[model samples]
Target: MSDSKSKRLRDPVHGLIVFAETEPLDLLAWELIDTPEFQRLRRIRQLGVSKFTFPGATHTRFAHSVGVFDNARTLTKVISREMKRNEQIFDAPRSEVAIIAALLHDLGHGPFSHTFEGVQESRGVKKRHETWTADIIRNPNGSIRGLLERYRVGFCEEVAKLLEAEDPQDIYHAVVSSSFDADRLDYLRRDKLMTGTGAGAIDFDWLIDNVRVAEIDIGAPEDDEPVNKVSTFCLASKALPAAEQFLLARYTLHQQVYFHKATRCAEHMIGKLLRSISTVANNGKNVEKMTGLRKEHPLIRFFGKNGECVENYLALDDTVIMGSLNALTAASDKTISEVADRLCNRRLYKTLDVADVGHDDGKKRQRQRTITRDFEAEIKAGSVMIDEKASISIYSEIGGDDDRTHKKLHILDGGKPVEISRLSDIIKALEKKEQFTRFYFEKEEDREKAQRKKGQNHD
Candidate 1:
């Protein structure tokens, strides 16, 4: 590709993303972008039902992926410059692999993004989006894998390994998957911008410039033993405020955008619809035939006994799911029709925050079981059907005891490497968990009936 032939894409979040012919990796990235599998991401919503809550959050995974690739490029250039200044050997190929891994990180996200994962998990399917991503990348028949192989013999496998964190100790590996990686950096800013939530503001340029590779001793070192020093990504002491802002941005995004009550309600409706559709489809019924769907309905494979065929998975996106929902609004099965109608018409389930719900894992489960039994008893006793939906835990375990990323992150204070928590109280506070549980009802009348029964029981 010549300089004149190089492509430049304009992005609202990242300004401009360029695929310069002068850069081999950029050209390769452009090639990957042109593939069908990568292009499918344009149809998958990045924030799932968050658009219902934040109207401007109609951004797709394709845009987010592009933003991530841009962030990776910026971070890699910074790392390369610092490595040269420090007289360290910078592996250009490894950096390229990291950049490519970042580009394809969310390739496996299904329709409605993370919301689809919740539906799959409820059905006892354990594979996450990352697992699907790895499968797609390693699939010999896939265009991404073919392109990677053509670029380098084992390049596809190398990229997959990086995505799977096979080389955790490698700094290049951290560039894509770590706590402060390009994925997080891009999503925080992009999400904030797209959702119109001006809460998450981080000086990305300062953070990128201040990032340095340092030798740090992870965890609590044993006494009288030489501390093992591993080269990992860290922020300079001068960038402590920037790092704090970044962490704050992540926390705020989760609170304001990711876990919005209305969005969760909409997501719960979708989950119920999927469950109803799956149940009907599993009974040897021709849902695709009845719905008159144009595309081969990929969801049929997901609802099948085996679960999630690659061919079917590739054909799925937000459009397919939305189209299916539109068709299902008139489904012959009442449950499927009602659920789909509610979702398509935005008549989402009403959520009631249960103050009595305990936070302890075991206690929470017991409370939930008791509430469910009572709710079902009411339903069996001829009360309106009421369903319970618990919001997924919004808290992240990033800086928790089990997490070792904090140990790897060092802040150079007075020419000495120090842990970031020691410098900022805001970052330390974010380490704690914040969780809420809510119950969902099919209708306001059902909720009233349940509450009346509960009051009568107390009397």
Candidate 2:
């Protein structure tokens, strides 16, 4: 109850992260981590269905959150040293705001983390986790806001601003949300380690030592004259290789781990299961009796009309959802039971990369449509096409639509702030976005094979 024990955590990625219990700023992180809301993060996995593919990726957002805070703590030390020669100040108040903001940035993620948002959107509750995060932090009735306000008057707003990324060039906000910020830094390493992908090996020590506070070009968009400047973390020229490795690691991990076909299939099942729940809800049936869940169950409340408030959302996490999925295995509705059993038992859908269909894009589309139409009519399982093309590139010479955070991470060369893409061919090449289109469904051949194998094993 008291801050008697040493405020320390044994993180697998970041190692031992210790905070001085006596220091006000350190005390803030310690107290916040102990809150019920923060503790809920332990029930939420960092990678959602990633564990279905990468068995070791069962790590919680709680660990990642702590790691981000550790990164912010490390960056503050860098800020203290790097900004000493500059006009900027890394004071205690801003330092507190930065680290706390990093700690609580992913605070409002729903059940199954990011993928669950898609389910919410389909049902028309379109408010994102960020919106919920702001609501939770600013809410007078919530636990976090009171704790933040107790630290200092109006401190809640300051931390919220950092999370909102109100000022991208502000060094503190940069630490929270910049292109190469602590969130990315911690997750790249933490996810790599947890997923056991052995990808995204960055020079963590080199990056920390090399990142410096600097004023970069901010005039291209806002003014005709390239006169205005903004301050943020810029990479030292020597850390180019390290930065390149970091960027490539993100791409490789996305390809091999984050976008693993099995993981994507598992996530797809979750979305389908939620829709199936909606179907069951729409039918005039005794939902509680059919599903064997309480009238006030998280899933019921979530799918109900005018449902999914902050309190309901908070009450739902990976644990609750997993439990709900298990409960739905007993559901009487044929469609809901089928989807729920598939998810609960890990009989996930299969993926069909569009490239495999044909050499030409037209041929691929034609073959894809043929297979999709055939599968829809022929397969009892979900045979819907999951066509999606997303960019895997992590770096840019010039920032994209969300330009604020991406452009600030410059490379300092020849006493000038240059875009990192200009200095390294690797970075420049990464600027050209790469995309992939893939379809996901279950194959009858594979299903029959699995069933036959199971029968043989029993014999």
Candidate 3:
């Protein structure tokens, strides 16, 4: 790539995204961005169906990917400088791998982003978007994999491994997927700016500036030989408040934007539309036969016998799903057409927060579960269709499942390392369980019917 070929692009959320030929990593990133796989991100919305709620949230994954890459570059520079100051070696290849992983993190998201993943999950498909991302990165014929291979012997594999890391203590791994990772930092800031939410006011610049690599004990016995010390990311004691603010911002964003009631309803409706299309397409029925539409549906091949080929997966995007939905509005099948029409016209399903409707303490919580299940059964058996959508838990625990666990973020207090919860009561309180299960109905009358059934159960 020539210097002329590498140009800086202006971004609304992240200012200037520079691609300089002088910097090897930037040149490589530019090459990767030029490939078809990365370019496909331009067609996938960062927040699926969120535009229905927040008009300005039509930003694509392409922009988010570039923002993440820029954030990763900053984080890497900070960590590398700190390492050099401490007379430690900062591996350039490892840094490059982290940046590339951050850039391609959402590469395999299907049309409408997580909405398609939800549909796949409902169909008993265990493979998540991350799995597809890994597959795309490792696919020999994939443009991304080929580009990475030209950069280094095992560059592609290293990037995939970094993304697949489950260890909470690995600083490099955390940089790409932790609670305070580049991905979170970019998305929080970007989403807030685009949605006009004004909810995520995180001191990201202060937090990043205060980040330092520290050797902390991984909770091993003090007397153990060679002491189980690991190099992890930590915040200065003075910046502890900033970290708390970040967590609060994330929680608020989840509540106010990501998990907004209307957005969730739209997501559920799209999932239903996809499910209906896949069912009809896979049952030896063509789109023309089912919908009488003489258009080339992008989903036909993928939903056919050989389920989800690389070519089919690569060809899918938001436009394809939107086009299919437009065609389905006239589908011969009433269910398919109705669902598609609802999604197209923004007639989102009505949602009822079941968690707030009933109260059960202790082991009696089983009663709440019973009531919810009974309500679902009643609705399913009635003249209306409903889908149960649960909000992902936003709680941050000291040691919990997956990457979002709070154990990843450490704080240095009086030169002693401790979890952020130990330093801030606000953060500790944020760890409390906060999740809700919402029942979605296709029609207002159905929602009323479900509400009456809930009242009868309570009575």
* Candidates' C-alpha lDDT: 0.73, 0.74, 0.74
lDDT of 2 by residue, 1-459 (tens): 364555889989888898875677778788889888899999999898898888899999899999999898898888888767675565867877888899998898887765777777776768777777887788777788988888899999988776765545477767787766788888889888888877667889998888887777564564555555667788888988888888888778877887677777777778777777765554527877676567788777766666657776788888887887777878877656777888888887666665554456565566555555545654445555464634456552111233454443577898677877778887677675554566665565743443333212210
Which wins on TM-score, candidate 1 or candidate 3? Answer: 3
Displacement of the residue 94 alpha carbon in candidate 3, Å: 1.1
TM-score of 2: 0.88
Query: What range of 10 consecutive residues in model 1 has the weakest lDDT sum?
Result: 392-401
Task: Return the clash pairs for model 1, or none.
Answer: none
| Model 3 RMSD in angstroms | 3.5
Residue-level lDDT of model 1, residues 257-317, one tens digit each, is 7777788777767776776666655654666554333224677666765556776788888
**TM-scores of the models, in the given order?**
0.86, 0.88, 0.89
> Which regions of candidate 2 deviate over 4 angstroms?
166-169, 218-229, 279-285, 357-382, 396-409, 443-459
Q: What C-alpha RMSD separates each model from the true structure?
A: 4.2, 5.7, 3.5
Off by over 4 Å in 1: 1-4, 217-230, 286-296, 305-307, 355-373, 376-410, 414-417, 449-459
TM-score, prediction 1: 0.86
Q: Which ten residues in a row have the lowest lDDT in candidate 2?
A: 450-459
